[model samples]
Target: MNPNKPSKYLTLVTEESRVEGKKNTERNPKNLRKHLSSIRLSRKLQSGIDTDFYEKITKKFLDDFYPKKCNNPSCEERILDKEISTRPDIIRCSKCHRQQSRLSYTPLMGLKLPLYMFGVVFHESFLQFPKVITATEISKRLGIEYKSALKLKRRFQLFCSDHLPKYKVLTYRALEEEYKGFKLNPDTETDVAPKMGLKPYVSADACVLYSASQRANKGRSRYRYGGLTSSIFLSPKLGGKQVGTLVHGICIQNGPAFFESVSDTKANTIGPLLVEQIPYSVPLFTDSGYPWLYNIYKNHRSVNHSAKSSEARYKLARNRFCKLSVHNQVIEGSFRLLKSSFSSYCYIKPEYSKLYLDEFSFIKTSKFFGLDCITERCFGSQFSWEGRSTGAREATVVRIGQEKYPHRRSSKETKKWLIQAIKDRKYQEPEREERLRRNKEQNKYDLNSAEAISRSRKALAGEMKRFNDFWSDSQKSKHKRKREIKYENLSFKIWNSIQYYKESSEENPTVQFIADKFKLDKRTLMIILRKWLKYGLIQKRKLFNKESHDKRVDFSIVLKSDSLPHLLYTQLPKNKKIFRRMDQ
Candidate 1:
């Protein structure tokens, strides 16, 4: 129905019903496309218009408004005439139905140009604009006038495409009609996500969008900006495609969220973050870019592709590798398609590069999959920071694997350790213990009265030195001060509390995390750990016992009876000789 047409219920009647509402309204049914047709006709009627120009404009108009089905109001036909009905807004047979594509009502609706022109522009941008050929060259290839090409470029710039997120979670009820052979009915039940009440370990990776690095203005070219799109994919065990959610995703500059763009996304990030927000422990999977991302989770696992492989390449590529290795296929495929299909998009203006990439990310996700999947896949769909708020918790259904998980140990063991530490009274350091002790010894320094406690710069420096000294040996103190509280205790505490921040997982601690977590001399601690590992402890499996090999070294033999028995002596090395024994 035309919104512009007179309303049957309202009083303001403009065009006076060509035929009364109940009286032969079918004679001239409402055709909203008449406006677009009028626009086309007006363009055709204009003087000085060339035949090529008319055909081009006419084609564009038709393509833009074409329908896949008969949109005519009077046509009550059930069976569709695909060929005739699929025509553009132009009439077919006596029916004269308006045509529409599935995308006509979407963000693509406002576009005024044809799809061929748009598709061509889209493909060209992926190759990176301002490279092999100029926009003029593109105009020649598309057979569009230079002005028309420029107009199409502007429209593409303004036209919004859809973006689909690589990661998506779907419940049994919600995941209907998505896959080819899969069915989500009552009888077709499968083990869903967060299996064993554990949190789902999702791996997130990002691909850089090269096409978004276009120069804004006409004259100069700058390609400083690009889009970093991140995806979080669920593992196969948890119902694979059947049960999953694209929990988070975002497009941003190259930063921590991207893990420096080495290769794969870190599942550690996805696991811990998901666990915190949702309920349960999540064993995450990821690439070597974030070797420790899995450790951040309360319960997690990982496979580093950067390591060497001893097996055959073909065998490794097959079922075993797929099952063992957590590959981000969806994210990887998205990158491949973006690069192949839209290479020309790279020629966007530098200023709009960021904006275009951001929108482009959304467009791609939405186009392939619907908005629902996109929402579940991209974390930053509604929020930012790669879809996670700085302080937001993960879902409970996820669990982050830890080196020394607290749940793995008995409660009695944990309690015993804490009690022993308290009994030893070795918790935090005493700040003013020395001053108080000295005051107690002197009668002139009244406990109630405030003495002249002005600190000298030199004294302050000395105090600082002592503090540094104490901090330097904190690891030792942490170990020896209480036999019950040793390295395992330390590892346990760290494993439990570190969460998904960069600190808890990396082999080397970030300065900030170290400085804040334990007031220790980080430099000294690092040095000590490194030196001890190299020099102190031998490999546990090595077998070498000097004492065991020479058991007779500790025993002295004194012959009692025979003279020959008394003639025993040790053999010396090289020129050194034993005492010459002669029997009488």
Candidate 2:
């Protein structure tokens, strides 16, 4: 049935219905495509106006992805053309006689466009548009109205957001399908990623993004949440698809951890934040900003650079050989580059930081995998959106210039600019005298300084051992502090034990718990408790109304460790009187 034709239920398109016909097969009864020869196919392919080809693609997509059986909630019957009496393309279920269109139960069920057109639009949406292809390109490629093309692009982008997370699994499936049955040649490029790309030790750093909603022409400036902070971990020498590619993990949290509330990134809050991300088995390479990492993990390396000037820190990092032997240079450089990209995304909401971080993560991972600047596999459909207000792409339009493609300029452009600069007598370029001197010095070592280089390497290795010793020695003070608390008096231990007893609702604290805490025998603790109770300083209640059972103490009488000792010393009599009272 033509959607434009007059319907029994409501008014729509002005076209009238033709004679209703019965169908008997799945493919079209007219064989509308048998006449399309090879020459005509080639011409239509060039002309970009082939209804028959698009229809074939649409039909194939529907058969593969959509439910062909009855879509009615109560029915479970196969739909065949013979059952469809009115519409040839639409079928009725054999059991319920309910009409079932190809778009039934899908988001496109009530759409006015032909199934083929919508199929192309959806395919483009998921695979091509917004990033790879624009609305203008889509309209030109599909040979559709500009309005229709723009609308389709928007609708498809929204749909992709709904199914965005599935793209990862789908991308993996696609890779497998593309390489299925091919022998593994063990090439260095592909083998490198698996072997060297999986790094355990990684450098960590964070950069903030100031992005905002771009819906209005000029949106509000202040968001309740602060700017987005992206904490990135980079492993440059990790196993990758290529020999030298890097892999990374990221977190968006504790934004603007300075001058903020308790939840911000302080030592106490940062420990829990980073400990959960890094596994215990992996060593952490960080700066002293994360001091708690030393306590939280078994293996970690941090260099104290906060006291040093920025230039001094840079010089220290550039040395390549250091006493600490731990550097965050890789992640530090990444943060610097990432900060430059934040200019285009200056108004980001703090809560949506993770989503924004994922965009960068995908781009970097794509480079690692040698995926040519495509974002097809960045998102997966398995995850749920945080809320309804999100998912509208924050960056609908971004200006890509020299900032994005800094190295894309050709030699001609460089020479042109240089010649122009010289003619204008503007010496803006840096003097290469120091750089040439370093290169000359390095080349001499490259030629015959092997013995000197080896000696220097050994000396540096020895320095690393010294660094480790210093690091280990620093932990002794921390250990001493821990021991001081562990040796507190029995009264203090009892007060701590009583706190546990008061907090628990079910299993009451046992007599043995207090004894174990203070390293005292259970009998001695009981004797002390019995003496206290006899002196009218404390009281005990019968368990389950049984006089022969366990006893419960009145926690209020001995409130704190300081007060308990004062009461005992002031009210109790001398030891000779205590002994006489005990004997009696």
Candidate 3:
């Protein structure tokens, strides 16, 4: 476009024309020497392979072949100048053209660094690396730039609170070995009887699950804080040798202005929480600390050595349940472990509580199967009975999305209905004012109940005396069999029922009498009776005696009056002929 110079398109052609046309000037010997010398110098420069030189050559080549142009539609200015070999980062145009700098979109357009670095930082922080430490610390450890590390840590903390799984299962194994025997501390007088296996009761108590807490103190005293403690239920199965899933966990405390505290001392707090969370009519076996609770929830049973008569306690001291002190001790052990392992939980940091639980849920599951396993194994037979009897009840909303639809009216109405339904359907009415009234009345009436108390005391006294009489015989025998065997085997009658045989035309003995006779518990005897009756081991007929309460029965078993009655019980296990193993 320059007027004074040859047309830009004809420059190459015009030069070649001159090179061909000119003889002496164009083909001069001096020119030939200069050209050959230039070629040699170029070869020498190439021989060294200097990286900087190569870069320059590449820049020159790119400039000559391809003129850089502004990508911005608003700017028509070329990045390369008129001199094909010369180019500048900041280019200008005489036509009043504007130039816009192009941005690199490969690493998130307009970003100073790659987006991957952001992800990297977020990921590292999510892994819970130390945050307060300088970026240099991370750089030294991960071998990255301090700047990158710093950015990553900052961004990760900002974004990763909700994405991670609250809990994860690291590992688990079936706990058969720990279930081999009950945990009975013979040295401790506090322990109840050890029966099934050692682990029992995963301890969980109600507390504020989440709430605001006093973040700062005033003057000289600590500020009152708002916070939550979850109602936690833990059950140790088979004395904690075997564990199960988290059976039930309820979060009861919620507030915007106040922090709520839940303690074991709060009466019925745990009971209601348990009922809300667990879908079973499970018996809550506890220690003496919860007499009030036990008094209320009839299903709640307590094992108190102090409450027992001296002889009875002594007799039961060696019994499995009493000897082991297995009653509800596992829950206490779990509490100790939880407090020890998670020291942060000591004061309950509100914000970090859930985050802590995220890690804890996984760790807990890994350590002791699911939370429910702890409850199931600790409660054992009762858990099964409750689970079955509870039947298919209403399902609980465990997570947010389990609800199909969520809205204000629906939520409020549902909540209203739920609260009313829970109150209405409770095993007993909440008692509200009635409980207070009854409590006051009972306090006064306790005096008049002296006769009843005396009667109960006297009956208990008689029972204790009888138990003591039997206990005294133990020291006299050089080789005394376990007194339990006699009591269970009916060596002495259970004291209430007397057996009578029919002298006239009659039927076989009822299963109940046969069970009573063998001293087998009703449950054990029932199975044998079914088997005997199936094989026609006894005849069936109806009869009545003075004590008979209508003894018509599906006759199953008849004890041989001549056979050693005790042997029938003691040898029953050994003699396969007595009862066959039915299909399980």
Candidate 4:
């Protein structure tokens, strides 16, 4: 019926088919092309997981872990030319006949997985820098157990951590100067010292990771069984208890970045760290919060984000474009990246924060160096497994051989020889015993002699005489009495008396007057005054005795203004007995 004149049903069906085809062709070309390419890419990648891929991985494993030279020191011939057997785990040196296992000393030692699976894991985890692949993902993708994938991933992380290069900007001389409280010695030869000019800028800042609040029971207690028992409900009050880890991060302009977990961001903690990590000559950019940065570094500049005045804001903006422009945005961006990386983990314990930071630093450093350089480093000899010595191997062989034999010795001839050696020792033993007996008798005869007794008595008398000369009873008692007195308390009292004299009278207090006032021993008072003068807490001035009309020198104690705060804040004992003897 539809052959000649198209039926309504047929026309409707044709129109519907045409519309569906048009809709399919009209789909977003960009998304359609991307979807098709991804499918092909995935298939190609999956196809690569074949025998050739395994062989390539095995070859690489052999190249990295195989011994390069004969272990024998005398015969260190290059073993690279030697052909690896089917079981490439162990290789033998052609010249020296020495054998070594490929995995002996490497992080891959004791690996139970196939080399291909391990290679896959390595390719996914290490090759993909800045892109994280969790163990669960690896397990799902590679069809391996989660525990195995995790172990492999952790091994790679540890390897990277151990072999990561520690970059230090400051030289040994600079570090020494910083350690010595930044005191410049005039005698130091500056002409020979290398000049570090126009050093690159380094920016430093800190960020908190895994910040979360703990929950507490906020509900009221309810009675159970007619008030016989009570139960407290936990309502989980969020934001009541907060916890986070403080991490200090630093990054050089167009260079690698570093991170460290710190307990605090105070000057005392971060100041020395900055000096150690960044050179003093280099310009440092930081926030206005760290006011002490100016005191620490000579070329330090801080940006005040909260500046209200237009002039101040304009100045900051101008500084950003000027010759010595300063900004810490590099470190700020690095912290943002770091926090993003940490976001992948559900929770990071405080103790392991350093390890995670090390990983982050390694990733940043690898980015700077590129993936090829990182691959070479990971395969370098530094990360190789250390093999056991030949002597140790021989000892193990001997132990196994002895275990195999019932009598320890292999044959009756060895047993007979051992028995003969033992008999020879037995024959010598008697003669040795006889010689010992004769020596003992001679010693007893010597002890019983009158000369021996007199010699012993003379030795004892000499020791007693020396002991008395070195440490007499009177000297011991004097030292003990002096040690019992609190020198700190005595010094404070003397300082107080000097202050009173300075404020109340025109003349300063003399040592003899203070000694008489405190009833302190003249010798002890001199010792305390010497310490005060040495520490610059007090100044000593020589005055002429006008009353005697003679050129006799008398010293007076004058407290220094610089040390007044130290004296004022110095803690003193609460007990009055400490100052009783000095007061008397």
Candidate 5:
């Protein structure tokens, strides 16, 4: 082959073929149908003349609010649908003369928008489901104010958040059908057997919603004067800051998922949350970062994403018999979809982060239950007007009011009342002065009494005694000295054990082995190992098991070259025997 020419392995494509491929991708029917459907829906909503949409929404409202029979016991007449058609908002019984407002006691109690327009907002919000439609887009489509559209959208999300179910699981047959060729059912009884007491595979992980510059001013003063002030300086790197809200998610394969905003990703925080959200019998899948899960759950498994090829081969062989893969890719892909849905918003505030998470979680749970977003389960019975009052509705509506002197008193009457009040105040001044002077004299006499003086002196002496005792150096120093001696003795014993291990075996000793030999707590030994590793006195190496072929991680401690010279020179009596046994 010529050195300058293209090799046989490499294939070159012309610009014409590249353009043709692009055209073919654009001409795909599925893509065309999606875009066209969205456009048609938006157009129909914006036109505001869809009578069928209005009728459908009105029928639903009537069905939710209409009583089965008339409220009057004497008549016992059933309210027919024809009698309810004159007014969409009010349902009337023809015989009993009873009337009811359709929106009363519901979420739409005092909705100001037209019935059809409200239907449009509802269709865009819940009917669309997982696809995010922002309030800005809704406002543009409905020709409404941005604040109105935002309030409408928030109301729907709040309803879903309050009513969404918890910990929904799919049937084994459903799971098997969805994930073909996977042995999800552990029971050998029957295909239609309930999944009760069976362990389902769950994947848990944490992800960031979005990142923002920590140095950015998140206050009203940033835009007070219509522009940024010169006194406030911002660094080019934004103070080397990247802040985001941590959200933890648990996803079941072909089933429901749960997400919540978390303050920290520590073991204590995540461990309790996982136990609360997931059942104890389920199998958990996560990455190697969550080693603590092994102790908490009985069926916990994880994959070493950062392992070398040899470690990966061992993991593969170890997990070859598992019913499900050992990776957490299910929840990882869920995080990607969640962040993509959140891309419609510029930024989500940490305070409102739970609402967004709950909204997404509700949608996922609804899909698992085979429920539509617009069904009565989400909108009708779940929504209430409890906290919302008539005053709140009145506050949103603008009205003209009296500008000045709205009270009953006229301007001349108010002046006369003020004069009378001033005269009354002057008349009582002399009596007020006498009373205040007498009280002051009484206070002075009380303070100078014998009992008061003695009480103050004793309190001062007690305070001084407590202060001296606290500041005394003898007690604190004695305790400090005792602690120092104890710590030094413990440190010496730990170092001696480490030196013994170094001499007895050619291979580095594992932390567990050393802890077992010295009869030390594993956590305390780990702390000491961490300190030694930080100081460069020892190095840590990951070793795999060849005897049992298990995937459990084992870390061995190796003495650094520079620190080996400083180890204890004393040798143990059993060192020779241990070395010979290891050589065998």
Candidate 6:
């Protein structure tokens, strides 16, 4: 090699490593050591990781986890300052002249790594990139040890399970007015499923839950399997790779939906999801396996479960969905898509089953929801699954403390850590207010303290109102003077986008996809697209007459009675989806 030429492994080695040269020895292996020491990987990672961003996030997480005033009743400190120590981030109590380990009181405590590196690990784990990543692969890319990467990976999995959101009920009234019209009750008894209630263009189903780790254990019983009942929706109006399904509530791509570990196909396990999630007004094109026409949902028994007719009696109660055009194709496709979404190791252990489910949920929804949103949602959570007084952190911290005690080289590290961490935690023990907040989060929007839910809904409603107001205002003028131009413009934008999606290998981009792309209202955009693409909406002008007003007619109302399905799907006041009265 030339004297001035850089080494081929220069990218992999750090400045210090280069200076040390081969004579100093590479950090390849030290099999005799019980645990491998962190090498130049930390420095390399630090250089790559955005320290400032991670620091801010760490501070935010710490503030949310730990309390102010040293958490010590006797301490006079009002505010804590974050400083770097052996633990990376510790809150120093000015008055007590003591410090509290930031991550020590949370799930992220222990498993030595810098806060910035931890942040990087978290940031990368939640990311939907390369579509195939393992701890080994991550270790190589992040320049960290495989074990550390694996630990981080496991922590993320646990984190996902622990902090999975208790989603707000997607009520009928809460749905956008546009989608509300399409949401139909599938109950055949109450005349709910109209002759023409069709919303989903196509749908798929996936109902199996298995893991590699779980299967590897021979003693693992078949009964231990988790039942993942999922539905994937392809929006009718949106063409070209536009699909949304119920994950939690709305399908924001890799969205987390109603998930449970139950095996039996009973109403109790599936009712809440069907009623709250499924577009009840919209015809669900499910397969023959789930021909559940009507289910007397828990907390929603107003619709007489006495059976609509012989057909209704034969269907829902019997689990007989025979002889239907709809198949489990969409969900089946989704399931296949899901399995392939992961790399080689597709199995998960039974212990972290729910967490694994939650992970898949977010992964699937990531396409629509965006990785940033998923990451924020995953991290901001308090990991409430364990049901502790202060939510997940309390239990997680305790577990971590116990786990780390054995990992320490001697009593010195453990004792020093315990003094600061345990003392701070004990001082800041959850009070009545903290407990109440936990309860609120755990139970979600209950009857008595519906305030939180109401507030959230109000916030969402305000956002929707603002969005609608802006579009509505624009339409108010365009509805009359430039309706045709509006139609043409929207048509061009929608169809052009569809073509673009197809050209980009998204063969069937949904109208929702287009609408989402343009930030236009789905209802409004779909309506225009229908007129232009399907209903022959054209603005005819007199030959060479610049001043002549084009002759065009609004064809939106014509479809209101065109067909039974059209009538059912129409926007008429009478056709509007009716919501069940609020529970007393």
**Per-residue accuracy of model 5 over 294-366 as CA lDDT, tens digit each:** 3345345666665543474454444432233466877987888888888887776655677677778877666
lDDT of 1 by residue, 1-584 (tens): 42222232233322444224324434545653554454455433342223333344434433332323455556753223233334332333235534334333222333445444555555445434223234575577566578767655444433332111122222111112212132111110223232323222244444543321112222223333222211111122221111111113321112111111111123433334333432223333334444333223333333444444457664343432233334444334444544454355434333333334433453442332333332211232222222123221321121112211111112344424423322232112112443234323322211111221122234333333432333234344444334322332333333233322323344323333433465556453333222222222111122223785654311111112111100001111258453222111
TM-score of each: 0.28, 0.31, 0.27, 0.45, 0.44, 0.41
Error of 4 at 582 (Å): 39
lDDT (10s digit) by residue, model 4, range 1-584 = 32123232122224565565556557855555655564454444442354346545655754543335576777755564355657656666777767776554454556677666666655555566566667787777666688887766665555445435432321222233333332211111122112223233468887777653222233423222121011111122332222356678888644568887765555545666676776564556687656545334544556766544447545444343222244588798888777777777766655556656776777665544343332322322111111222211121110011111111121334424423322322211123344334423321110123342344345333433432333223344655434433554355456655765676677898877887787778877876665455445577877778886676566888887422211211222256232222221
- Residue 390 Cα positional deviation in candidate 4, in Å, after optimal superposition: 53
Of 5 and 6, which scores higher on lDDT?
5
| Tens digit of per-residue lDDT, candidate 2, span 1-584 | 43222232232222221111112222465533432343344433453334544555665544443436666777744543333434435756666777767654333444456556756654443442113334566678666688877555444433332332333333333323433342211111123223222232245544333322322213333333342211111111221011111123222111101111111233433444354444543445566555444323424455565443348535444433222345566566566555555444434433333333444444333322222212321222221212213321321211112212111112343324423322332112212453234322311101213342344335333433432333334344666534422332233345434644554433444455556556677554655565445534344543342465755432232322212221121122336354232223
Clash total of candidate 6: 43
Error of 5 at 212 (Å): 2.5
Give the residue spans of candidate 5 off by over 4 A. 1-51, 58-83, 91-97, 126-129, 166-200, 214-243, 309-324, 372-584
**Which ranges of candidate 3 are over 4 A from the true structure?**
1-202, 205-264, 292-299, 303-325, 344-359, 366-584
Each prediction's whole-model lDDT (CA): 0.32, 0.38, 0.32, 0.50, 0.51, 0.39
Candidates ranked, most accurate by TM-score first: 4, 5, 6, 2, 1, 3
Q: Output the lDDT of residue 440, model 5.
A: 31
For model 6, how does the per-residue alpha-carbon lDDT over 1-584 read when each residue is reduced to its tens digit?
Answer: 42212242224446675555443344544422312223444445344445656656656654643433467778654566646554456667766667776655354657567666556556665564425456776687567788878766665554444433423121122222224444322222234324323322223233444432222333334343333221111122222111112222122112223343332244333445555654444345444333233222110111222322456435443323322232334454555555565435555433344444565554443332233322222333221113222322222211111111111122344525433432222212233454334433311111113342243335333433332333334334544424533453344434434443544564555544455567778566545543333322222112232455954322211111111100011121246453222111
Query: The CA-based lDDT of model 4 is what?
Result: 0.50
Candidate 1 vs candidate 6: the TM-score winner is: 6
RMSD of every prediction: 26.2, 26.0, 25.8, 23.5, 25.1, 21.3
Candidate 3 Cα lDDT to native: 0.32
Q: How close to the true structure is residue 86 of candidate 1, measured as C-alpha lDDT?
A: 43
Relative to the unseen true structure, what is the C-alpha lDDT of residue 174 in candidate 4, on a scale of 0 to 100? 25
Per-residue lDDT tens digits for candidate 3, residues 409-494, read 21233324423322332223222354334323311210113343344435333433443344334253433435334433332222
The TM-score that candidate 5 achieves is 0.44
Residue 504 of candidate 3: its Cα lDDT? 26
For TM-score, candidate 4 versus 6, the one ahead is 4
